[model samples]
Target: MKKYFRSGEIFIWFTGMGLGLSLIMITGLLFLIVVNGKDYFWASELVQITRTDGSKQLGEIVKEEPIPNLNLPDSLWNKGLMRMQMKIGNRDLYGFDFQWIDEREIKNTDLPKFASTIERIEFGNFYGFVKEILVDGDVKVKGEEEIAKKIGSYLDITSSIRNEIKDIEKSKIGKINYNIESLRLEIKKIEFRDKNSVKNKNEIARLESEIAKENRKYEMLKMKVDSLNLLASRYAVYCEDANGRGKTIPMINIVRVYQPNNMSFLEKLGFTLTKIREFIFDDPRESNTEGGVFPAIFGTVMMVLLMSIFTVPFGVLAALYLREYAKQGPLVRTVRIAVNNLAGVPSIVFGVFGLGFFIYFIGGTIDQLFFPERLPSPTWGTGGILWASLTLALLTMPVVIVATEEALTQIPRGMREAALALGATKWQVVRRVILPAATPGILTGLILAMARAAGEVAPLMITGVVKLAPSLPFDSYFPFFHLDRKFMHLGFHIYDVGFQSPNIEAAMPMVYTTTLLLILIVVLLNITAMIIRANLRKKYKSATF
Candidate 1:
């Protein structure tokens, strides 16, 4: 045993075991997330459940489990009965999306082939049977066959109308409003510069004329939208719930209606894929409980890229100064130690500092100097993508600096001396030899920094991340990338959906899906960085040696 201990074989075994355990845990976690998230998109058969009390319940059986601390009479508890959780998603009628049903109470159940699941604009999903399709306030289709045939046409019309409305509101009307706001700001600027000058007055007059023209155009668009809405409102679908309660839902409000029980495996698979696509591409709605997270994905990528842009150069420069230029002394050692310690600081502290220094001080100064006309409203003097990126850049700078310094140190002193002896200046040696050799290490630091920044939610929440951003940072506006705009983030989106949602059960699937997406994104980024690093290492290895 003493010989084995001295040989360090036990320590090696322990280290290997620990690493293996870590890999297993990580793989298990990823498997769990995939299993839970992927099924959320698949269409499950609707079941009509009949209880002992003669009450009817309908929904997809989402989950079942043995009751924890089973509360039952002694005789009943002995049976070890399990409980079933049903997704009775008629939120508008039931006021909840889920329900817990005791197994004993469920006397009978059957998969209802005619049962339909309606995806709505608000109040979550509605599970019911199609009773009638009313066009122009008359029951045109009553039977299931007739309703199914005309339902597709009605849905197509509604979809077209919805697209038109979206275009008018988001594109045409939005542009007009943006132009009007710009004109207002310009007039304000003119008034601030010269309150009563002829040039100021003429500029203001011209802006007002432009605003009036835009407003007229906006009104015409609004009128057309109202006409489309009226046409859409005329078509309605009446549905009857499992409890025999009837509700009339407008065609415009119903996103989709599907008979899940009747669907073939291929049909279900296609529907699942379609839903997954929508989740990836669509904008989030229903307070982020429903729809896609495209904005969050966009914001996260944009912020990380911006942070990299800010952090890389400064970190590299600082490391170069410390490693190559600074004299070896207690002060330099202390500075290095401080930089190392900075990595341990709480991320939220950096957020507070960013809020105070970047937003309040620097941004406020910029606003006062350049955008005085927009005073009290605060353009830059608020949480925004720019500040958030800068904040994260500051937070991750130490990592880069340390990695770069280590890389610089690894480059042999003989190489530096050789370069100097060959009539190369210090700058030339560093730019040509040292930096090229250190590219792989620099990228390693960048990968680490990006992984950290992408997953960080606490720092982002106070900096510039919001539950929902009205518009993307990039747009058709001049100076297209709006660095001053607030943005969404996947990390914050997970936190919000997991902890802050009104419907925990409804949001749980979304939380898992978003988590999986974030993991995939981080992995993709790291893989890309790793590829670059590997290429750099291969290219420079011979030169370094």
Candidate 2:
């Protein structure tokens, strides 16, 4: 045993075991997320459950578990009592989407073929059986089969009209609103300069005339939308719940209707795929308990890219000065210690600093100087994408500096001396030889920085991240990349859906899905950086040697 210890094989084996255990734990976590989140998309069989009390409930059975003994009598403690959780998702009627029922109370259960799950625009989902389809208060389809077919047709028309309404509201009306705000700001600036000028008065009158014309146009558009909404509401689907309660849901409000109990394997698979696509591509709805997270994904990617762009050059330059140019002394060592210590500081501390320094000091100054017209109401004088990126850049700067310094140190002194001996200047040697050799190391630091930045939620929340952004930072507008805009983030989305959502049970699936996507994004970024570093290492290996 002493010989084995002295041979260092024990330590090697111990380290290997630790690494293997870590891999196993990571794999298990990923599997757990997949099990919980992936199944959310698959259409489960809806069961009509009849209880001993003669009450009926309809929903998909979500989970079953052994009953806990807490607050129970001794006689019931070890009786092996079980309970099943059901997703009875008629939130508007039931006031809740889930319910727990004891196994003993569930006297009868059946997979009802006619039961339908309707995905809606509000109040989560509706689980019921279609009774009839009504057009203009006239029964157009009465039987289940006929109602389903007619409902599908009406839904298609409603969807198209909804799309048109959304386009008009977000595009044409949005542009008009923006122009009116700009004109108002222009008038404010003119008033600030000289309130009595005839020229300014005429300009204000012209702006007022344009605003009135725009208001007329907006009213016309609003009327058109209201008419379409009324037309869409003319087609209604009457559905009856398990308890025999009837509700009339407008066809326009329903997103999709499916009979999970009757769906075949192929149909279920297709439904699951469609759901997954929507989760990835659609904007979140119902307070982020449903729909997709495309906006969050876009914001996360944009912020990380901006952070990388800002961090790399500054970190590389600081590292170069420390490693190559700075005199090795007590001051330099102290600075190195400070840099190392910054990495250990709580991330929230950085968030506070960002809020104060970036948003208040720098952003306020910019707003005061450049956007004087929009004063009091902040333009760049508040939390925004630019400040968030800069804040994260500052937070991750230490890691990049350390990695770059190490890379610079790895290049032999002999190489610099040889370059100098060959009549090359110090700058020439650095730009041509040292930099080329250290590209991989610089990228290593960048990969680490990006991975950290991508997952960070604390700093982003205070800096610029929002629950929902009205528009993306990049659009067809002039100066397309609006760095001053507050944006959504996947990390923040997970935080919000997991902890801040009104319905935790419904949000759990979204939390896992967003977590998975975030992990994939970070992995993808690191993989791309690693590939570049590998190629660069190969290119410079011979030259360095």
Candidate 3:
């Protein structure tokens, strides 16, 4: 034992044990998340239950658990009794989406082959039998089998028409409105500047003419959309629950309808894949309880990239200056200490600073000078992606500076002398040799910054992040990148769904899924950085020689 202690073997064993325990804990957490969220996409077969009270329930069996504190002689807490959670998702009819029932009261339970699960636009889900397909308030197809056969293909067609209506409303009409707003702003500016001369009036007339044309186009689009909506509303699916409760859902409102009990393994697998795609690619709906999180993903990745763009060059330059050019003195030492201390400051403090300095001071000034026409109603004098990125950049820069300084320090004095002896200037030596050798180290700092930035929520919430953004920062609009736009974030989404949502139980699956996605993204980012660092390390093994 003495020998092992003296040789540090005991410490090594302890360290190894600690690392192993940490890895196990991480794996366990990931497994838990995966298990809980994966069930959200996998189509569970619908089960119909007949209770002792003669009531019938048809829905997915969410889970079952043993009774707590079971008493052998007591009927309420009987030894073998248990309870089950059922996602009886007909919220409009039931006023709730889930139920808990004592297993002892269940008389009989069986998989219902004809039971259909309808994913609707609102009111959660409908689990029942498709009784009729009605068009123009007339029965187009009646009976369960006939409706299933005829309505199968038309639902998909309805979805396409839904997309067309969305494009016409949001994309095309939205652009026209945007253009009209810009023209109005221009007119406002001209009037405010007292430049309403003949030429300006002619310009204004032209602008008004353009606005008139846009209005006419908008009216036409609105008419077309109304007609499409009318056509869509004409078709509806009449469904009945196990207990004979009936509801008519419009074809346009139904996302999908499937008989999960009848689906084969391959069909379920395909269904799972389709759901995964939608989760990754679709915009969230129902206050982010349903649909996809594509917008949040886009915002997160874009913000981190923007933060990196602002962080790397400035961080590297500051580090280089501190290590290579700045005089060694008390002031320099103080700055280094301050930089190190900055990392420990509360993140929300940075958010406050960002809100005050970036948004109010800088953005407000810009809006005043460049966008006076849009005064009071700010273009940039508010929370936005640019300010959010800069705020995070400020928050994470110290790590880069410290890491980069350490990387620069690792290069031997002999290398500097050798470069100098070969007639290389200080700048050339740094640019050519030191930078290449320190590339791996710089990337290490970057990975740390990115991981921290990616998960950060507090600063982002006050700075720019929103629960749901109306539009993404990037589009085909002029200048393409709308840095001044508020955007959604995965971290914020997690916070919202987990805590802020009205129905946390229903939001649980989404919370887990978003959390897992965030972890996956962070891991992928780190892996890419590490891979780059490894290659760079290999290439510059001997000080860029």
Candidate 4:
């Protein structure tokens, strides 16, 4: 024990135990999030259709019966239909329906144990007029036979037409193949002769002429194929109509519902993973069926990119000035103190400053200069992508500056002295020698800044974040990116779903999943930055002082 104490192994053991405990705590938090949140990632089906107008209800499509499940104790089930309601935007939304059926309140109650199970549930748009009934009962579903018959007819007609087109395509392909074989024989004969021979030239020219003729035939066949493809796409889309009518049926205005099993953590985690995959790859807009997270993902990436672009150069330069050029004086001391103090400032304070200065003063003037008609509604003056990025950059500036300066300080003074002694220019020395050695430190700062900026919700909430973005920042349009637009962020999504949502039961899963997603994104960004830093360190290891 005395030897171990003298060698400081006891300190090492204690430190290691503390670090291990911290890691376990972090892992436990992540595990809880993964298990709780993954369910809401799946696209839920629309079951109950609630109409707008505060009037009659439209019919509900009960895909599956509701399974008897309860998470609460029996005391909570004594009251009648208890519902949680909330005001979202301009609408009053009703969430899960909690029923309290007491045996003492009712007489001769014989509730069936083997009732139909509800596989999934969704609430449709309450903003549209729904004329049908919207309640779940033990009656058989209507419109099956008529819809099936119409669908069968449409499929039969389209199939026959598609088959005929395919046969014609096959015939054209066969002809093209035969011509290719003939051309190959001519090429083989030409190859057998000497390159300088007149016989080889004659054979090559003849084969070329035949190939040109075949090309013309191929072009004609391709034109036919294009026309047939257009027809096939139209036919396929038409056949997908649930009612089998070609009339454009705008999707039933409905919110998605999923009948979740009270499954274990592992099953829920698997389900969540599947949902995330669907959200990423599947284009739900094709049928206007389900919403995906693509826009949100795009916005998050674009915002981070914009923030990094603005912050990195400015932050690095600021650090360079303070660390290298600026003499240590009262001004320098004051600046250092201010920079350190800035790091402790509440992020929301920066949000307000950004709103007033960048959004109002600078952006307002620009909007007035260019867009006179849009004076009141400031284009870049109001909450926007550019302003949000700028705000986050400013908020995270202190971290970058402090980190970079510390990195610059770590370089031995001898290195700089050697550069100056060798008659190298100051700019050249900094660019070639100092910057290379400091790359790792700069990247560490960048990763920290990125992590902080990505996780921040308050500043973005007031700046430019939206619950549902109208469009992504980037698209294949003029200007490519719309800077003057609000965007959805994973962090904000979590807040909106958890705190603001009326349906706690429904939103809980989404909250956890979005939180997990945000964590994953930050981790990935840090990992990428670390990899680049490591590569730079390897490349310039000899430059270290």
Candidate 5:
């Protein structure tokens, strides 16, 4: 036997081992997802309806158990149907016979009951059991869009409609008072004519008749006001209610919602499938429920969007000035140093700056000058999406500036000289030749900025990281982006679930799920950038430095 260690063989071997380890880790992740969350994909929670006698008992069927020896030989087995009785009031709701068959068992016969007075019966599957109970509610679950529309409708119709009705009632009461006053005058006028005369009696009767009519009108007006008030109250309640189906424990309903599929479905779709069903679709019972991640997601995305919209154009322009036009002076040198230093500032410092400058000072000025109606309560003068985005953009400015400058520096002097040599203007040379060549680098920088923004939790926490967002930032409504409204983030979700949740046991799985989802999103974004970079490289291969 001969042993030969070729050049770079050790490095290659190490690389291979590293890759194998990564694959093993990924496979382990997939296995966990399959074992825990696969059934959650195909299986929608089934609402167990237990209606016996005149009463209805509504609750989630948390779990089902099976009776032992129910599958034994016919001679040994108890000769009775093994039906699980659900206690719904005074009556028993039994599971349908032979419907709960295990795959391992061949027999489809009646199961044994422990007693005929039967308060309990076991229901189980032979292979394994499902721990996640089905949740049901009295009302049908709605999606984000539907819920937003409903919320907007309530805000629109209820508030204005109720106000109008209230005004109408007030007017009607005034009219009634006017009528009563007129009748009082009429009685006073008839007082001198006679104590019991026929003319006086007729006048008194006519006045009484007028007063009775006014009273009826007033009652009708009151009823109308009350009805409007009740409607307005209900709408407000529904807008706030997470699980609005019923008062009972959520009835597990087999709901079909478009959700973000986990790794398995993504694999099946060639890693292209972006969305799959999740428990988040279920109406949330509380702010911490899986259904409630909407707020955090919304907030996080909004913050990032706001940051990008502000940073990119501004950062690019500033970089262009420093690279293309600005004279080499102490002032320019100082500015460059400042920009570089800004990148190194702790993110928490930006959070503090945002709290003071964006949230309070600038926002307060805006609140005072423009939005007088929303004043005192401080519209812009609050920790909101707008300030958070602005703050993060300011924090990320140096990164963009540095990346753009480096990209510009890499552009060969020959490229610019050639463009000028062709009689092209300086602006044309920069725009057509320089910037286009640097687009990929610029995009790469932007992608890096986005990744950083997505993972940022500290600055956001101080600025506007809300646990639950009432609405999404961008919506179908006018000005669709509601920067004032609070939003959600995956980073924050992991933090809150892992640290803030009271029931760590229950929230542990959710923390994993959320962490996994965040990783998937970041990976997808980076992959997209890689694709873009590859395309750019192909297009500009000959235009080298």
Candidate 6:
């Protein structure tokens, strides 16, 4: 034992155990997320259940758990009473999507061959039996197999109309709105210049005329959208619940209709893949409890990239100055200590600071100078992508500085002397020799910073992140990258959908899916950076530097 202790075998065993435990914990967490979240896309068999009172319920059985005992009698303590959670969708009728049923209340349960699930645009999902398909207010199709097969074609028609409506409302009309706002702001600018001057008054009148034209254009687009909606509504799906309660859902409103109990494994797999694709690429709906998170994904990736652009050059310069040029003394040492200590500060404090310093102070000043017309209502004087990126850049600056300093230190003392002997200036030596060799280590710091920034929620919560953004920061508009626009982040999305949402049970799947996506994004970004660093490391390792 003494020999093993001296040889460090005991510590080695301890190290190995710690590493193994860490791997297990990480693997378990990922497994839990996958298990809970993956099933959100996979269709389950619909069970038509009969209660002891003879009332009927139709839904997919979501989960089963033993009832928790709370101040129960001794006889009930070990009774093993179980409850099952059912996603009995018909939100408009029932006012809720899920129900917890006591197992004792279940009189009978069977898979209904005709039972179906309908994904919709409003009131969430509808689970029931299809009674008929309507086109032009007439029953065009009836019967299970016929409705199931023919409904898709009608849905295709309605879906195309819905897409056209969306394009008109969000794109063409949106552009007209943007132009009108700009013209209004231009009038404001002219009034600020000289409210009573002839030139200014004429300019304001011209802008007002332009606004009227834009409004006329908007009305035309709105009319077009309304017509498309009216056309789509002509096609409908009339469905009945287990108890024969009927509801008429227009085909335009219904996203999909499928009988999960009858679906083959291949069909389910294809459905799952298609649903997953939509989740990745669709705009969120139903108060962000359903639909896709493409906006959130775009915001997160864009924010991280902006943060990288902000942090790298400044951090590298500061590190180069400190490690190469600065005199080593008490002041430098104190600065180093401060930088190290900054990393330990609570992230929320940084959020508060960002709100004050970035949004109120700097942004307010910018708005005053550049966008005086949009005052009080604030164009740049608000929480936005630019301010959020800068705040995170400040937060992660210390890590980059430290990493860069370490990298600079690792270059041999003799190298600098040799460069000086060869008539190389300090800047020349740094730009040519030191920087090239230290590239990988500098990337190491950026990798760490990127990972931390990608997962950060607190600072972003107050800085620029929102539950939903009307438009992405990047668009076809002039000055395409709208840095002043607010954004949605995957980290913030998870928190919002998981803890802040009204329907926790319904949103749980969305939360888990967002979490998984966030993890994957961070991993992919880091992997890309690592690949670059590896190639750089290989090139430098082979060099004579």
lDDT of 2 by residue, 1-545 (tens): 99999999999999999999999999999998988887568898899999999999999888999988884578889888999999999999989989999888989899988899999999988999999888898888898877766677788888898888889999988888877877788888888788688998898888889888888888998898899888888888899999989999988888899898888999999999999899889988999889999999999999999999999999999999998899999999999999999999888889999999999999999989988877888998799999999999999999999999989988988899999999999899999989999989999999999999999999998999999999999987778999999999999999999999999998888899899999999999999999999999999888653
CA lDDT, every model vs. true structure = 0.92, 0.91, 0.92, 0.63, 0.60, 0.91
Which residues of candidate 1, in runs, are more than 4 Å off?
A: none
Residue lDDT tens for model 5, 359-462: 88998999878765444667678878888899889988888888888888888999999999999999999889998888777777778888888888899888
- For each candidate, give its TM-score against the true structure: 0.98, 0.97, 0.97, 0.63, 0.56, 0.97
For candidate 2, give the lDDT of residue 205: 87
Listing every candidate in turn, what is its Cα RMSD in Å to the true structure after a full C-alpha superposition?
1.3, 1.4, 1.7, 16.1, 16.9, 1.5
Q: Give one digit per residue, the lDDT tens place, for model 6 in 246-336.
A: 9998888888888899899999999999999999999998889889999999999999999999999999999998898999999899989
Counted clashes in each candidate structure: 0, 0, 0, 16, 22, 0
Model 1 scores worst on lDDT over the 10 consecutive residues at 68-77
| Candidate 2 stretches greater than 4 Å from native | none
> Roughly what TM-score does model 2 have, to 2 decimal places?
0.97
**lDDT (0-100) at residue 147 of candidate 6?**
90
Residue-level lDDT of model 1, residues 215-296, one tens digit each, is: 8998899899999999999999999899899999998998888898888999999999899898989999889989999999
In model 2, what is the error at residue 384, expressed in angstroms?
0.6
- At residue 468, candidate 3 shows an lDDT of 91
